[model samples]
Target: MSGTAGHGTVKGRDFRLFWFGETVSLLGNGIAVVALPFVAVLTLHAGTFVVGLLTSVAYLPWLLLGLPAGAWVDRLPRRPVMLVSDAVSFVAFVSVPIAACAHVLTIPHLLAAAFICGCASVFFTTAQRAYLPTLLSDAELLSGNARLQGSESTAEVIGPGLAGMLVQAFGAVAGLLANALSFLVSWISLRAIRVTEPPPSPPPEVRRRRLRTEVRDGLRFLFRDRILRTLAVFSAVSNIALTGMSSIEVAFLVRTVGAGEAVVGAVLTLCGLGGVLGVLVSHQVSRRYGSARAVVICLCGAAPFTLLFPLTGPGAGLAFFVVGGVGVGAGVVAANIITDTFRQRYCPPDLIGRVSASAAVISFGAIAVGGLLGGVLGELSGVRETMWMMTGMYTLATVALVCSPIRKLRDFPESDESLRAAEAEKAVP
Candidate 1:
């Protein structure tokens, strides 16, 4: 019931509520991830390009609204922003099943729903990241992030198989309804929290600045910092490849690999298991090898496995996809936990929202691009060929990290002053 601002642990009532709500929400999202594409492909008989476009539409809001949402979230109450976002998402997802039941569902309708959910996700994710630090002390962030990521990964494991069964028994629309309900739970959980968050306190000069000025300040801070900038660029490149491959994964599984709905879900579940494993070991990995080294090790080690994707086929060959996915998923999730904790600790409190948004705009915007590219390539080239290209790009993208200043360091700097001191020391040589 009490506030957890300076607490060294994340076991406070408010945090538990937050975590439970997020875990359920993520489970629903996992279901929707399979449901939406299956609906497009099975119910409507959509082609590869349309399916890819659907994925892109779901992420386009990050490009369209990310900056402004971050700016506004910084000025507003973060919890309320998250609540409103959840409400909006609930409406958007709930509409899908309603339209399907009415027999009025169309591709355009699906696209519209995806766009709306994407917009809500932008604000909700931005605000949630900013709100988390308030619930735990600096030392608690790593453990908290690991727990949250672990829950998310667990949802990924359960949700796909559940979605497959729901689609098989009831219908694809059933999955959407479940997702809609999850948002409602999240809304209730957020509302029940008793902790009173402090109001935003920008410096006098910052307070007078306009929205654009505030956004610019965040971007400047993010880019001016060498480590943050390097990580952002690496994420941007990696996301493009990752999203591109994912955009067409369902199509490839169904068409190229001859996987049924249940099989598709099963494969994704196995991959999610890898993510869970990553979360379990992320702390020890970072502690033993150092966060900086851990990130590089995870990414580079995972990159080569992507080559296995293009080789995936039916029967015994399906093992290739499973193996590749498990490796890549584990590495990406582990690296994300470290980097997310780093950003939360590294950025200042007042500017965390903007900084998070700025980083996301670059990193997540690439997702839209990747989705479109994957679809177009799937249409132009074969799905298998496109997979080859995307996976190859994914492997090559690691070079950005290998060459960055982070490669020279063991652990990441705790603050900008420490970073500057390190840079000065390096310069003297």
Candidate 2:
């Protein structure tokens, strides 16, 4: 049992299959990161505000459906939820190329597609996060998560560059097609997993009252847990700043830095390399320094470099953004891996879906707010100024983590058993 547990993830056929599918899907998402905006700007002749609006619309589902999605995922089978999500995204994305081919594509149609895909993502992502603990034991989670983050970071590193070439060669519509195909591949890979999920614990027979009660319970638990609450707030604030930066980034490159599409893609790709570096280093950092301290150190260390972004310029000066991007990327991913692992281990198995969803509602919902803010700010203050404003906000957002209770701990809770034991002691009356 010890030997099997030690290298479980490495030898687990189901895990490898799941990881491969997610990796492919991540790469497709990377392509869309570049493709979707280009389609709005180039194909639809969208302005900076419209571009930001498009980005905001894509994340709007998190605000609208994030909490409910989490509750629903907890009540249903995770694999089927994921499969359904992929199918929805597949249809929504594939519709774009079909419309484009028939000459009926418009900005509204693209926005509708994005909104639909975003809704699918809320269910898929919440289920997937909850599902990971089922696949790997607590001891295997760090390594498993790191491997997943590494592949996702790699996708970020490669996706944009590929998107650029595809857009340049086959046009923007090709990226959506690529994304659709990727979803089909993900569906097939998930369908092939052989692990039988444990049956969900039965809920009370309250019918309509049960769903609302379960959803509220998730929200209540998240806010009641000090560590989870702090982490959730930190994520929400950081996402706002990050999404604001991203919302106007293409415009910043095109208008302020005088970059073409290919150059923009290449530069963003360079930024993504830092995430790969972060993922590779996270396990070692957590082991040596501990996860709690690692989060603070990573955030504090990465905060200052963001100031470098606003200084970026056309020609050789653009290297400033690359340097800043690398720092932000590495720090962000390291922080993410630590927090994600912590949540998986710390939350109760029954509540994780709701916890993930509730947390996501705050974090991802902030993204929507940030997107709109970025658009309004960009239109008023200009893109470079907005970058400076947004990046500066990110630097300040670390204060939440610095002051949080986690900083007092040596490390996050190690496992479900340890966490449950602590809870039992606290429950003594």
Candidate 3:
């Protein structure tokens, strides 16, 4: 009912619509997370490498198409891009069930579906991140991000267990069908939104720039800023380690930890519950501890608990993973809310798409590589050992944050006005 610029809490009608859509989409994706690999491993009898490849393929589009997608999103209406992405995902997901029902499903078909949906995500996520600023003012950005993260985490908490149940009761195909239906719900919610988006504004010279140049410009902008550069590198490295650990987690639980399918799903659900708790308190923690300091505390401080994961074994020892996961999930979510809010407030509106894309490219690319690495390492060193090694790598990645300028500051820089004032003061001498 209002323009793109609305001010208030996240409870506003416009923000609720966006949040609800994303929550359903995330829940669908969560179900598919378990369902997808199960289809390969159980139905098709694929191996570890193939299961890992499924994840790698889904994220590979971020590396290949991320830059161009960002520039394209900058030039288009974000909502339309999101709608098209949802439609693409819907079709891709729906195809899997159809093929399964017809008994024509093959690994190649699954891979193709994953790759196509991944490409859709590349466009959709870039647009959505860029579009959020349009929906809320700077002051509300933190609240908005926290609320969104909470909803997503809530979905994560429920999705996996549901997936496990559906897979057990009906089949993995049932989860895929649920995911397809979720996208339809998301599309409808997005269509019903009443906020009017402003027109895209590429300057004459910018419009004339080559696609390569535009992509390079986004990369340049991210690297030119010290804070953005540091965070980007940190996130990339962290993703590599996190993905490696996650890629093997299901296998580790089923084989090494000696847990059943339902148990594994429950453990992962606890991880999401931790994320929800983190989001619930993130705003207060940032206000109390200082957002900049909170990032360091949440990340570097909590990472060491990853050792708990490696200590996990059969029966009661498995609860170690639940505790470790809670720490990691809570810490990571809070830090993300702080950093994302900072990025939104600090970056220029026009460049937000490119900037967000540039960061996502590296981070998501690392996830792809990490997935492959996990598979290889699992084969070579054994799954439990690989988890230990990857956890160490993740813990070490936090060193980048400690070395960055952000470590020395109480609060991260805020607003273009504050940035300009600080620059002017520096030049006064």
| TM-score leader | 1
The 0-to-1 C-alpha lDDT of every candidate, in the order given, reads 0.90, 0.87, 0.86
Candidate 1, pairs of clashing residues: none
In model 2, which regions exceed 4 Å deviation?
1-4, 7-9, 206-209, 415-429
Model 1 Cα shift for residue 306 (angstroms): 0.7
lDDT of 1 at 119: 97
C-alpha RMSD of candidate 2: 2.6
Q: Put down candidate 1 lDDT per residue, 1-429, tens digits, no spaces.
A: 134444435678888999999999999999998888999989989999998998899999999999988899999889999999999999999999999999999999999999999999999999999998877778788888988899889988898898899999998889999999999999999999888888887778877889998899889999999889999998988898988898999899998889999999998888788799889778889999999999999999889889999999898888899898889889999999999999998898878999999999998899999999999999999899999898888877898789888898789888787888877998995
- For model 3 the TM-score comes to 0.95
Model 2, span 1-429: residue lDDT tens: 111356425558888889999999999999998898888877887888878887899899999998888888888889999999999999999999999999999999999999999999999999999988778887788788888898889998999898888889998888989998899999999999998887666556633456778889899989987778888888888888888988888888877789998998899899899899899888778879988899888888888878888899888888988888889889989988988988888888888999899999999899998998898899999988898888878877887678788788778776546756776998999
Residue range with the least summed lDDT across 10 consecutive positions in model 3: 1-10
lDDT winner between candidates 2 and 3: 2
The segments of candidate 1 whose C-alpha lies over 4 angstroms from its true place after superposition are 1-9, 426-429
lDDT of 1 at 260: 97
lDDT leader: 1
